[model samples]
Target: MTDATLAFAHGDPHQLRGMEGVGIAHDGPAPKRIVTGYGFWIFLLSDIVMFSCFFAAYAVLLGQTAGGPSGAQLFDLRSVALETGCLLLSSFTCGLATIAAGVRNERWFQAAMAVTCVLGLVFLTLEGREFASLVARGAGPTRSAFLSAFFALVGCHGMHVSAGILWLLTMMAQVLAKGFRADIQRRLLCFALFWHALDIIWVGVFSVVYLLGSAV
Candidate 1:
């Protein structure tokens, strides 16, 4: 027999050609959900890397205040504590929203998401007030390298939270209009991943920036 015939006789012709394993033992494309989630995770990882760079920059410039206020001088533990509580609680409500979505419970899902949105708003409001207070006290980003690093790190996180809130609202509207459609569900899953990621990043910020910065 010819080489092709011999190879086919030894095993499956497609396997011999390596075509069967090309799909990773599957016959077609991966499920949409898996593909979407994997892509979203890549995006999340890139975001994390960016935040890590910001953190490193902040650390390097932590004490670069040119005769200006430092974090320990300007940091308010009470407001930071309240912000932390709101964000952490929002993470919990976000979990409940995910659970409700899984069960296709529209009412509960909406309610949970609404609560999450409210908590996120509260967190942002507190952050905004804190920023305003800092700026009023001549500690704005332009005041010193230390303040610049602090604002860049914390402000970036706040922008992400704001974006997440907008995305959360969009998800709510999509679900209400589409009734848990597959695409809607996929978007919701991505949103959950993004939101949870923000929560984790915030924890890091709280520990590194707020806690450590305040102590120093």
Candidate 2:
């Protein structure tokens, strides 16, 4: 029944006003994707705020080298560029995966997720090499406050990426086992948002930590 009709039928607009809604059925649970996405968005915002604090700390400590090597001496821009490219490509593949999930295309979804997983692994591998080379050259996090902050800021991001890779693999396995269930699709939505958030954070990291660090 219409809102007005329902109100008249109930003989009380006050009761209708206090209710969730008069026209729509309020008995069933909310769509899982909407609820899940809202919760995940809150989580992603909290994560971003945490990262912002780390960024702020790094900014404050950027000049505190303690007689150790600096970004110019330590960062290989080419390697960082490669890492950035891999993550960007992974984001693209993740987008494809989301699209495929929405359309219930199992093959394309798995393919896209696989590519994203590979790209993420490549980014992590390059990052690991970068860290190793820095340690080998006596530029470890323990060497200086600047190095410490750098590792804290970037390492946290790396850990998030690692988690995302694991999540992606789990989703792939779930899709293979359970097919395109609604719960699984909702999970894919959350994963896509998380992966995209990493891309955004990386842009800031490259700008503030890598590009500006090397120049200034």
* Candidate No. with top TM-score: 1
**Any runs in candidate 2 off by more than 4 Å, and if so which?**
1-30
Please report the TM-score between candidate 2 and the true structure.
Answer: 0.87
lDDT per residue (tens digit) for residues 176-216 in model 1 = 98899888889999999999999999999999999989887
The local distance difference test score of model 2 is: 0.92
Return the TM-score for each candidate structure: 0.87, 0.87
Q: Rate the local accuracy (lDDT) of all candidates.
A: 0.92, 0.92
Question: How many clashes does each candidate structure show, in the order listed?
Answer: 0, 0
Candidate 1 regions with alpha-carbon error over 4 angstroms: 1-26
